[model samples]
Target chain A: MVTLNNFRKHYKDFDLNISMQIPAGTVTGLIGRNGAGKSTTIKAILGLINPDEGEVCVFDKNPREFTPRDKEAIGTVIGGNLLGDFITAEDTIAILRKMYADFDEPYFRAQCKALELPLEKPFKDLSNGMKARLRVLIAISHKARLLVLDEPTAGMDVIARSEILDLLREYLAQDGERSVLISSHISSDIEGFCDDVYLIERGEIVLHEDTDTILGQYGVLKLSENEFRDVERQYIVACKKEAYGYACLTKEKQYFVDNYPGIIVENGSLDSTIILMLGGR
Target chain B: MRGVLEKDFRSYRKTVLLTLALVVLYAAFCCLMPGFDLVHSVLFVGWMGAVAAVNEVADDERNGYAFLMTLPVDARSYVLAKLVYVTTVQVHFWILARVTLLVGTLLDGKKPDIPALLSKGLALHFGMVALLMLILTFVIKFGVKSILYLAGGLVMLVCVFCVLVVTKPDANWVDALLRIGRFPHIGIYATAAAIIATAGLTRLAVHFMRNKEF
Candidate 1:
């Protein structure tokens, strides 16, 4: 649904160089630490800011050139405070209904009602979790073909997060072609909800693979100093010294299991993978 | 554009109400005060319109302009909507000011100087439109925070120019202003010029907004 080709943007303290594709009918998660260019990449894709070089295409057209009709196919939930303090939920719905021809007002109201959001309360008066839910509700209620969510579940409790994830699952299930690109710091959410994941560090894409591959085929092998020295180097993608010994990330989990019978191997997770890949060697 | 205008209206509802109340109070004051000149009231109305425009711009900034950009509207449309809203509010205030002046004059049992009223009202209206357009351009170019510095700098510049004019040995500039006011056609010409200038400024604002990074 969206593609970034050699996208480059330079800031005073950092430079973002990213290339990725978010295919249709799949949930793609972008995981990165703060200042890792996640938001910058999203901004460039949204045409909120122009990149110094390269191109971003959404639905085969540059976002900078998107007409209102083209934009109606995309929805977004950006992080931080969005609505003004004076605007209430009712006012938001009224405004959005006029802005989007396909805006599903009933769906939005139903979602808000289900979430127990006060329709008359000003946005500033809502709790952080409520605000997050409201953003998600608005994004999904527009009947958009793609939903670009940045930290959509941030500040929400476990129950709220679970509910939102379920809502996204249902939303995708309703249409085979709908897609989502979500960026969040919470690895568990990405692991649980995403079909594919991209690990970004210092504006560079370190890894992009299917979630199943990361969880099943990739692994971390725990070894003592002596054992680590004897282990084959070809299987290790990244390694980090630990308090007990060392942990090495391996893409070929079967090779490690078959060759090293006594080695301790644990299933790879997004968090552990990021730590080994981004942490100092 | 309608969405944008509606958002602004709801956001500024309180301020609009406050402005209306102030206009009513000022009109009442004008009716009671002996030898009350409507020119000062016209200027006050102009200031009120400017205040509304500035407040709307500030509110949009504070409300997260980035969020607005994410909507299914382009930057040009956003800028145009703001221009339309500000112009509508200014026109509304102008009508209110005219009605107040006329009612006050009638209540005071005075034969209103129709020509003088038109001359001052038209001048004030033109000035307000120019001021609003300039402000909109600045807001689009530099964001809302710059408005304070811009307004302060403009006030200082105007003050310096006024001082220079008052201290000048020649009275020609003052005489020229008086002479222009005497010609009723000058009001129509100034109105036409103000409209043209506002249209040009709106186009400039749209250009600035198109290049602006959220």
Candidate 2:
């Protein structure tokens, strides 16, 4: 369980004010574009950056005040390259084994082998996909109750990405006590795995709701110039216009589809929904 | 804590080895060359301090190992681990120096009392470690290169002051060290205690770093 209450952090150029909660036994996705403060949110939660205001608690304990037991229950992977270029996968495992008492070494080794990561090669020597997989393997091997991942699949190929997704699903399925919070630019990954989605824009949360509910409710409305001119302003959430037509977006996609049967309708993907909600695709 | 130290050890193995080799070569050169005991000791201390200071400052964060920040490791443990590593490296170099000195004396048929040498070395070792710890605190608080520049300037200032102090007809090098190294044993103890206290302050810095949102 994690809770952030009116958390605010400010830099010279950027600011973050967020209020969020991740309930136990549920996967939450943090969705945002580049420079949208997704990483800042994760950093604030990890206590890597002290919040200028508000509070963050993990399993009811503040990150700054976590007891040993509380810390032991949490694991985090903040980057696709958790181990630096000079460190090898074997070196990472050895160091982790000593730091985390509950680390499952054999299981971790098996995962590494299956993932085809070279244990003895330095991290810089590995491909980006290999490094990403290795990072996930390290985080999951800790036997932690909560796993926080930031862009863990950002550099992987389609197959590698699917493998990671499958591994995460398997983790949730087998371990009922565990919860996950993963942030990625890939909207489909978030849609496929996250139970709830948090869409952030310019350091503020725009929406937090069930992934399916948001996806099902929003759609794009393609209109010719005359039709766009005739449409109600209030109904159009966002519109990208050109000489040929206007591509209008609306939150009441189902209503638009049923009422305007003659108009063209396309099933809205998560990406489009975010683009509309954030007012930028 | 053991984990942190082990990782630091493995990570900086190259630097540690190189430092050891340099210390041995310097000590041997000091013994072989005539009348350089005091200069050798001071240079040895300075060299070891510089190496320990740089390694302490740069090895972790520069190498992208800040993910260690996510672990349950306490700030105190991180500082202690660094101190332990510097001290361990110091001990290894000290042992190598003693062995080299003993072998040199054996070949020359001039055996100094081992107990007396050991006592002096132990005192010097504790003092050197304390110095390294205090210097490392500053290095971590500032950037390594900045600290190195500041230290160099300070050393130059001290050398200038020493020359100013000993501009008399009979002020030899031995007299200079004797005059300089002479504060009471209490002064050394007090300085060592201050160094150890700085380690606590460095822990707070680590906490600030860990909690820094980046």
Candidate 3:
């Protein structure tokens, strides 16, 4: 549903060059460290910021030239750009009702009631969790075909994060053709939720893998110097020297378990993957 | 654009109501009190319109433009919506000012001649709103500090005007206003000029908003 073709954005101290595709019916997670060009990529996708080079296309049209119909097809919860803080939930409902032609008022009201968001209370008065919920609610309630969520669950407790994820899960379950591209610093959130994850560091896309492959097939082999030297290195995606010996990130976890018996074949987690990819060779 | 206008109205509803209430109370004060007349009504309308427009601009900035840009709105639509909202606020006050004029005439045992009062009041209201648009379009471009500067400048001007008023209480302000009001179709021309100026301002604002980073 969204495609970036060698998109290049250059700031004074940073340069971002990325190409990726988010097909319909998929949930893609963009995992990154702070200042890793995640927001810039998102801004480009939303047409909020201009790219110095390459193309950003949503539904086959440049995002900058997207018409109302194109915009209505996508929903967004961009960071630093949320609903008016002084307006109430009822006011949000009213505003959104007018904004989106297919905006489901009853659905929004029901969800608000279900989420325990006070309709009469001003948004500024709502708790942070409530505010987060309202922002997500606004994005999903309009029946958008694609959701570009930029850290929608940021600054929330675990439970609040789970609730936000649950909302997304419910949204995805309802439709197969709908897509989501969520950018977040929280690995665990993206790890357990998204189907695929793209690891970005220092404004470049370092790794992109299916969550299943990252979780189930990938492994971190903690090895002695001799063991590391003797082991086959083709499957090793990244590795770093440790005091004990070396820590190697391999895509073939089962191969190591089968061949190197009793070795420290720890499961590859999002966090470990990030550390190795970003901090290791 | 309709959606943005609706959101603005909803956000500023209470403030609008309170301003209108002030209008009624102030209108009554001007109508019955000794040194009050059309000029006071003009000043009140102008001040309230300027305040509402600036306040709305400030609130939108505080709210940030991220949420606004995410919607099915382009920069042009966004600018148009803001212009419409500000104009609507002024129109609400303008109509009410006519109401106050009618009530004043009834209390004075004369025919409630609203048409006679329409042109002068309309021209002044539009002129003030136009002046505000001239300020607001740039305040929008330059962001929050410019708004604060604009507010500060307005306060200073008002203070200076107040000082002038206090020092020259004997001056025939009413007669001067009457003479200005009698200028041939000055109201019609002012309204037309304001509309064209505002339209041009909206275009300029659209350009500014487009080039602005969220």
lDDT of 2 by residue, A1-281 (tens): 89999999888999999999998899999999999999889987776678789999887777766644466777787763454456788888888888888989998889988999888898778888887888788778888889899998988889999999998888788788799999999998999999899989889998788887766876788888777777666766777764568777777778877787766666666887786677633
- What CAPRI grade goes to candidate 2? acceptable
lDDT, candidate 1, B32-149, per-residue tens: 8889886677778777877776677667666657767788888778777887777777878787777777777888787887765555576566667677777778877887878788
- Give every collision pair in model 3: none
Instruction: List TM-scores for all candidates, in order.
Output: 0.94, 0.87, 0.89
Assess each model's interface with DockQ, reporting 2 decimals per model: 0.64, 0.47, 0.57
Per-residue lDDT tens digits of candidate 3, residues A1-281? 88999999888999999998999999999998899989888888998877888999998888888776679988898765365666888888888888899999999999998888999998778887888888899899989999999889987899889988999999999999999999999999999889999998888899999999999999999999999999989989999989999999999999999999968999999999998988899
User: For candidate 3, what is the DockQ-based docking class?
Assistant: medium
Per-residue lDDT for B1-214 in model 3, tens only?
8888888888777567777777778888878975457556766866777676667766767677766787998888877778787777788777777777777767767775556777546766777666666665776688767866776898998887677667875679844644675788777877898878877877788888878776
For model 2, residues B181-209, the per-residue Cα lDDT tens digits are: 67556445755765676566556556544
Rank by TM-score, highest first: 1, 3, 2
